[model samples]
Target: MTISAELLPQHVAIIMDGNNRFAKKKHLQKGDGHREGKNVLDPIVEHCRKVGVKALTVYAFSSENWNRPQYEVDLLMKLLEETINEQIPRMIKFQIGLRFIGDRSRLTPELQQLMLQAEQRTATFTEMTLTIAVSYGGMWDIAQTAKTIAQLVKEQKIDVDQVDVDLFAQHVSLGDLPPVDLLIRTGGDYRLSNFLLWQSAYAELYFTETLWPEFTTEELDHAFGVFLGRERRFGKTSEQVQQEKIEN
Candidate 1:
């Protein structure tokens, strides 16, 4: 499953799903499944880095996840704190920039501080950017960006007529990076689940039944292979695209 260099996705986003299902199937505690899922991220990030991916965004915790049982939520927060503490050194060693995109106000003060420290410590890294979405929702991201833009307008910093698709997008999450080239969802899910709505507008979507903890590097290569086989026409016909390629 060697993906052609030209077909490799520059930015890949993942919806990590099926942690609870994986745990249930193993007859283990849900927390254990989450821990395993968290462990899987490091290897996947390493794979992405080795494969020349510029950015990888993972859906870690959603804003709607707070509706779960309190104990589970608490366990998740604890896991996040511990994972952040452990990954900081690895990130620096690998030269991977660590960043979080989401509403941080809901995160514990300690976790917030740790996240900030991780981001600051790896700010100079250039190998790859790893973005974890915690307490994040696509709708929330869009709304927050709109709010910020509205504030600027109110302050007379910008005119309403200046607002366009590009201007609006500049305020959205991950606005400075390349648009998502591929979006992978595991655990048999077929939906985006409110993850990166604006950024994934034209992304190639891949879904799999493999649980997060069990999704392997081989599987990732398979996804890339599939991506390479697709003919991306955007809005043009296949003949038109082929003709343009030939002319170029």
Candidate 2:
């Protein structure tokens, strides 16, 4: 329930993978795997909030996911909509803000409406924030930020030379939140898969063989343990980091 402040990750990101594989491995119906994965998030969210993480971001859908089989895509969309509907009250119950960061144009109008309303309903919760990346990709998020910066340049709001990391960062999705301190990928993947590329520039990465549906609070704890056991030096040498820690 409680963790050391120095070891706690203010922001955590999860690449929830292996739903279809879980289905095949379990001999379940075609879409049941996704449904099972969907059910796994609530407790994780609660646990994150309980452990003092300010923000939790999950990869729900990606821009590239549109290429999946139409039926599978449809199932994902339905599940997303259901997730929004189901999470709004839970968000309020836990005093957590719910947010969605991604391209909304590709979503159904009805689903978009639901997402907007859910965001509105939970906008005031300040204890923690849950961000679902739907139709989201790191490349897309950065491109959108670039486009906004270019538009501002065109409007002469600021000089083009003024565009820097800080300026560009402010325009990126979830820029107001803490940078990702821990990124967890389930299902044995060792790659980022284009999720939160910029936000997780210095995050501690945790990979696990457990499928998403099987990922639990215990797994999260293990990831935190791994994070604490390692050292994040940023660009500093080990000696410098250790000296700084001693000074603090």
- Candidate that would win on TM-score: 2
Give a tens-digit lDDT track for model 1, residues 206-239: 9999999999999999999888778888899999
User: What is candidate 2's CA lDDT for residue 178?
Assistant: 88
RMSD of 2: 0.9
Where is model 2 more than 4 Å wrong at Cα?
none
Report lDDT per candidate: 0.92, 0.94
In model 2, what are the clashing residue pairs, if there are any?
none
The residue pairs in collision within model 1 are: none
Q: Candidate 2's error at 101, in angstroms?
A: 0.8
- Judge candidate 2 at residue 189 and give its lDDT: 77
Using all chains and alpha carbons, the TM-scores for the candidates as numbered come to 0.97, 0.98
lDDT of 2 by residue, 137-209 (tens): 9999999999999999999998989999999889999999989999999999799988999999999999999
